[model samples]
Target chain A: MLPGMTTRGYHHGDLRRALLDAAVQAIEESGPAALSLRDLARRAGVSHAAPAHHFGDKAGLLTALAVEGYDRLADELGGAGDDLLEVGVAYVRFAVDHRAHFEVMFQPDLYRGDDAEVRAARDRAHAVLRGGLAALPAAAPDRDALAAWSIVHGFATLWLAGALPPEAGRDPEQTARAVIRRLFE
Target chain B: MLPGMTTRGYHHGDLRRALLDAAVQAIEESGPAALSLRDLARRAGVSHAAPAHHFGDKAGLLTALAVEGYDRLADELGGAGDDLLEVGVAYVRFAVDHRAHFEVMFQPDLYRGDDAEVRAARDRAHAVLRGGLAALPAAAPDRDALAAWSIVHGFATLWLAGALPPEAGRDPEQTARAVIRRLFE
Candidate 1:
């Protein structure tokens, strides 16, 4: 078990958190498609059935993770305030910093996107993104929002996938700021 | 076997294409990380060793697929005729039309991105996109190119991930045209 995780603390509320941390580790080491609940149980140093007892199944566990991811994203974007450029930079930073969460969050096939908590958290994140867009002129703000979202999301996704060329540089946030400035400036 | 695929045609120059087709099918059904040489061979209706014989390993097979993806993308973008907006639209269309290939191509961890053939094909695609950017003003063209690429790539990826809101509308090419216009206009 990772330090701070406990196999015997299920009822005390630490086990669920431990299992999620283990799941993140597993996903970072290997992508989420290979994730199995049984493996998570072993990683958490709990009973074979312990993961199922907490999450019900793999999708359930992933749903919880996705919700957490969105909540984190919402917080990060919210912290960037109303500067659209800063919000875009913050979005890229979130993807690079919380890669495991970012990976699982976008892949809806791995989790229940319709789950109430997931939708709530996702909407919160979306609202934060949209709030930054409110500063733009009202001429087709929806399309502007979509364009803004796509550029930042693309930069983040490409950076994470290692698809960008070497000249794109190492710092995602700084690179994203430059790319985003081309559009909104 | 999919129509036109054969179980007995190993050396007639058709098996390689047939196996790649099966791999695309398998990846469409499941994501790339779950892909295996043995499973692909089974799906191809060939000896379990056939996939390894043709591609050497799973990464080799995915590398081949990524090369094909880039080639096809280069062709499509090249055909878009120097208009950056059209090239962006074509990029989105390619992603929507070739989901399996698109999914595998971007996830560089699943394949040998540095392979000579992969690099050549990917460069061809990148050059096509860059050619479209040549029509813009010379000031900060690199950042402009990066922004344009990010918006289109991000839109296509988000569309594939089903992460876009419903009001964003269907017809990826049309929606992409509007989104890409926001940056270049």
Candidate 2:
């Protein structure tokens, strides 16, 4: 429970969620370079060391964010049902919508890779992608999966970085669907 | 020239190359987070300030490396001689061989983005890719070019990040070629 949190007067059953939310806001405004536990605590209206109790360190907080991101991504993408292309589009959508988590999740150097929670969360997300890939035709599923994953991931990553062409005109979700369709064609 | 380096010393004309070489070695050893101009100068047996004379700043040094990388990539892809798939394969090869530059070039925040030299070099590389893409069949050239570039760039980026499956057993160049071939199929 951070000191200045909106739920400061309460025992705040979900202090962890509050911290994570504050982290995302901080990351969005300052980028990953300025992430700080004390600032997070201040923003959350808890004691300066409250974040340390929950996350242990900056890396621990980042690991937690990565885990949450993976879980959310897996849930969103998995819910796309039988449509592999839809799942691909959902993956891109998750990235765009959760920019802060998406940014930290991929930069392995920024988090504790060996943490069991992080590992399990990451594996869960990967399983969703693999599952979606398996839904494709069996003739050359592995290759097709790799191609599909590569295009969607690449496009989403580039688009977030503002490297994609403006003339493409299609929104990120539409662009992802268009690219994934070509993979099967 | 960084501090302790001298035009009158035994290594002057070659010192710039030596410093760049040392920078690559450092990036490989510790990743980009650990890169420091003073550290590079120390490793090169020069004073901390000596690097400034040659590169002006850390961004300048990185920009120089990026410019060199773009030139090398353009040359390699150009040598593929108008075969779109071959050019795509060459793109993957460049990413693998020049891992340091490939990593830095894409991370726009880490370099001097407004430098004319860097922009020119990057544009030259883009021209090579665009030229090869233009050689594809006339129908839907715009979409085809975007797809072709996306697949090759996506494959190379993912492969370099160790996200691709090792059990696939296919070399990067082969995988790149296969992915690109799907565009026309």
Candidate 3:
């Protein structure tokens, strides 16, 4: 919201977006498991009940994050063009850049995986991934998709964990492109 | 230990191991972030102070888990012989069978990453992974290793998260083998 343009009590659609943005920041700093709806409300400069009204509770908030994450991922992967290599690189980049959302989206325990919005968004993201793989020749198409998904997901997860050795160095995306290209060989 | 082999007040070396084992179960059920040392001590049927004595705090216990996880990973990967394919398969197997350890091992923030024991074990594990990649030809061998690591790691992570399509079916190892073989192809 613009700094001084809003009335104190005026409700706007921007509140939800602002609250979700606050959630991403909070989850990034404190992790998904420690996220608090009350704190997010405080961060958003709203009444304690404001976030709960929009999200119902913590799980509800996380469910929204997962859905939003998948939608954003679908956008990124969809925009990566038709090349499987570039698509794979884009997937890793999305995970690294949206670390908090990526974490919640995958860990079903963190949110309701069966939520209608979550399931729909997840399917959309999966479709984008499979669409990118259409250019590749494979002994088994299904298994190939799994392979592509696994390697990129693993790299991003490892990179986030700091489990990968420092050898990859400085920039995750460039190093990821070099690493991801090996699958084609 | 067998149910019948019981003794009261026995201070065997097993206390730490037993506590660590309990931690694995707790972590698997809840998560690393929700881990409680006091609760672990209770589950292990020890004094409340027992867990703290052995681990200092929750981070201390997680640090122990990280060390043990890296050591175990090294053992599995090292024992897979010179074939990098088998080593990758073994890596996924380790993640599935020891899900808790695998989860904590990657997330550096969950424990003390800079501790001497953790750094050494991490190096040993890294050495095992790099050793497995030695059999492959690549434009860049080090990045190839990272690629190899990322794929298997990503697959296992996806599988654990239940993020993979149901097509993966009831058997993770079988599905994982097929996907992992693609890296070699």
Candidate 4:
């Protein structure tokens, strides 16, 4: 092992995590469209080939981000309490706090859809949201789940896009709770 | 005018419309972030500089698209009949049919948010939705409007993102009506 610039001395496991972290910052700075593995590699202070080796290409890196995003979303939604209203608010909170992941996760065209990891991660997140719908009173479970997801997802998407009016406010969790409360009523 | 290859003979108004049409098709084929004026010019059979002259940059073109989108949304929402349910259904239809426009309109970072045309157009669409909410029984006009917008907007966004489960089915307008009907119930 040589000095700071030694290529062979760096751990592969650490490099992958560093690249993923750099991706989040890059996405936050510029929307996911401008994400480049080369930039991530440069930001991580690794050789250019390191990122390409770990993620293949732009879509591959985004798929990784999306997989991480879905898993995180599942963890948050499943742990946000069993109350439907609370779950709905938690959905919004996750989106706001994880804007980079949320944005990339939804734009399927931006990532590799065939990756098994992505599919499984997405399933986990869906299960969490769908499970929360069991508490709702609609005669049709599917339609009710769609309704519950849409209200929260739509609010989150609109909020992130800055499409909502000023009165909607910046407190995603609080505002989401108020709007979602109407559904239960 | 000398045949089809001359950029000098291309009318400014005609080129502008052609570029806008190209953008819609391009956005539909690839998500909005991948849109390039140069690619649009090649698609439109105009000089490379023609698009830049009209829209200035990538953001300028998207701003135009956003403006057109909002104005069109206002028209559809206002004319979807006096019933809020019908209006909500129409909103879903617009989103599905005009997916390209709808996608760009909401993502303000993709365009010039402060552009006068965008602001005015957005206000027109907002007024139509806000006016529709007045018929509801809520003491809080703004919150109710936000709720209505969130449900319909969320449903549309999910449908477009393919985020809703297969049980929600392939017909967006139908699923949207069923889900949105929850609010009216």
Candidate 5:
């Protein structure tokens, strides 16, 4: 380990948090596909077996990340108030701001998609998104919800992939709002 | 090499096609991130150096895959005719049917997004999508196009991730048509 890079005196929770933070950084640099528990432990300045011990394996670690992602997304969406447009903007913003989490959260093949924590957290986020649809016209609320979700999710995915044309603009939230407006209003 | 696995009598184009076919199968089993030229050659029953000679590296091979993906997508979308709804349904169908290509094409970071072939092929696909929008109302074509792309892309992504709720149903093209109708109707 490098000088000053030590896990000395770190409590259990702090160590876990540090490892998770290191994972996010590593994922941002590479991607979820390249992740390994041993590498995460090395980055966290812990024992080689530390990550595996804590998270069980790479998929386990990614499962934790997905759970955190869904919770954070729920918080962001809930905080955006009950307006569907603003919620859509917030969804895009969350995707841009938390890119690593966003990447891992959507790729279920990379982690334990059936984990109970993930399901509950995902449901929380979904409920918040559903709450936003209350402002839409009552005709076909389920269809409207799917449309709203699809537009924002698509804009975020396209933005992250750099697949959008130049006219799509640099501002994720602004561009997402405009795209989402086509579905409503 | 395994028994019955031989590259004898294979022409240049045939070998390349065989490698690409092997790559698609591998990606379907694992993903783009796990792809390696050596493994593809092994799967194709060619000499270890053959894949390197043909594609240069994993990214090069994936770039070729992305180009092929865009071309295939263009063909599928074009066959949908001038109807935007049909085009959207076609987009989802392409994603479901060509899972490996769809996965690699959208994740631009996995390959050379600026490759001339990729750009040209992607433009062809984009043109088909744009053509479908001619059926939409004339208020804001550009915004409408973005919305149309987002909805279809998003639905396809969610379907692949298994992120959509149970109510979304299992039939991709059918579900996509319903989700898309919310935007224009």
Candidate 6:
């Protein structure tokens, strides 16, 4: 062990969170293909078996990350006041800021979607969007919700992939607001 | 060899197209992960190595598939007549009808983005949309084009992921039309 490294212990109280943070870093650096529990453990400076004890397997770690992602997304969008368009902007902002989490969360085949925590978190994030849409006029709440979700999610996903044009120089939040405004115009 | 199967036959003139068709079927059935060149060859009733003669590797095969997808999308959208909303509706129709192609085309990491054929195909598809947008008044063409592309592409992507609720029961084409109509309203 390196000097000042505390490796003479196995009772890592925050091992689960540490492993998840390491996984996010790994995904950001190398994409999802390079994720491995052993590699994550090594990066976390814990024994190779430590991550297994906390997460059970690679999928479990990803599920935890995704669950956390949903909660974070919900919190961010929920704080955007009662303006539906602002909530849409917040949704895009969350995706841009947390690209790793957003990417893994949507790829259903990468993690067990039925994981209780993951499902609950996803529902919470979804409910935040639903609530925002509910505040819209009652003529077509469902349509507006789907449209708003699609525009923000699409913009964020495309921007992160570097698929947008250079001329699209506006910040993500601005672009999102502009697009969402057009939805109700 | 199995009965009626000739190993040394020189009749693979259409093997390239056949392989692409089989790949589309495979992708639709199992998504991008389960696609295999050997399996595609088997489905095409050709020798295992025959696909290699047309596509250098699996990525090459996918590149060709993406190219075809872009061409088909351009054709569908271009044929939507003068109604921009109808064009958006056709975009969603393409996604629903050609789920396999839509899935592979968007995954930038999976295909050779720099390939000349792929670039040309993508540009052609983009031109179709650009041309459609050019027909609108000159005042706000740039923002209008971006919004139009984002809405249609985003809606199709979300719908295919089954992210929308069934109670939103509005068909994708109908929903796309409504969203696009709002852009001009």
TM-score of chain B of each: 0.93, 0.89, 0.92, 0.93, 0.93, 0.87
Per-residue lDDT tens digits for candidate 3, residues A1-185, read 65533344444668888899999999898788888888998898888898888889989999999999999999999999878888988998999999989989988887888999988988998999999999987678888888888888888898888767668897888888887777787
Off by over 4 Å in 5: A1-7, B1-7
Give one digit per residue, the lDDT tens place, for model 3 in B34-134: 77887887888888888898889988999999999999999999999878888888998999999999989887887899999999998998888888887
Q: With candidate 5 superimposed using the best TM-score fit, by how many Å does residue B153's alpha carbon deviate from the native?
A: 0.3
Chain A agreement with the truth for model 6, given as TM-score: 0.91
Error of 1 at A20 (Å): 0.6
**In model 1, which regions exceed 4 Å deviation?**
A1-11, B1-7
* Two-chain DockQ for model 1: 0.79
Error of 5 at B42 (Å): 1.9
List where candidate 2 sits over 4 angstroms from the true fold: A1-15, A25-48, B1-13
Which prediction has more favorable TM-score, 4 or 5? Answer: 5
Q: Write the per-residue lDDT of candidate 6 for residues A1-185, one digit (tens) a residue.
A: 64533374434556666778889899887666458998998898888988888888878778888888999999998999778888888988888889899888876666888888888888888899988887767566666677777778778877777667766775888876776776665
Candidates by TM-score, descending order: 5, 1, 4, 3, 2, 6
Model 1, A91: alpha-carbon shift in Å? 0.7
Rate residue A108 of model 2 by lDDT.
Answer: 68
lDDT of 2 by residue, B4-86 (tens): 54753636657888788888888766555457899999888777777787899888888888888888988998899888888
- Can you give the lDDT of residue A79 in candidate 2? 93
Scored against the true structure, residue B67 in model 6 reaches a CA lDDT of: 86
Score residue A92 of candidate 3 by CA lDDT: 85
Pairs of residues clashing in candidate 3? A151-B151, A154-B154
Which is the leading candidate under lDDT? 1
Fnat of each candidate: 0.77, 0.27, 0.88, 0.80, 0.67, 0.35
CA lDDT of A136 in candidate 6? 68
lDDT digits (tens) for residues A1-185 of candidate 4: 64533374666676788889899999988889878877887888888898888888899899999999999999999998678888898889999999999999988889986689999999988888888887766688888888888899989989988887779887888898989988876
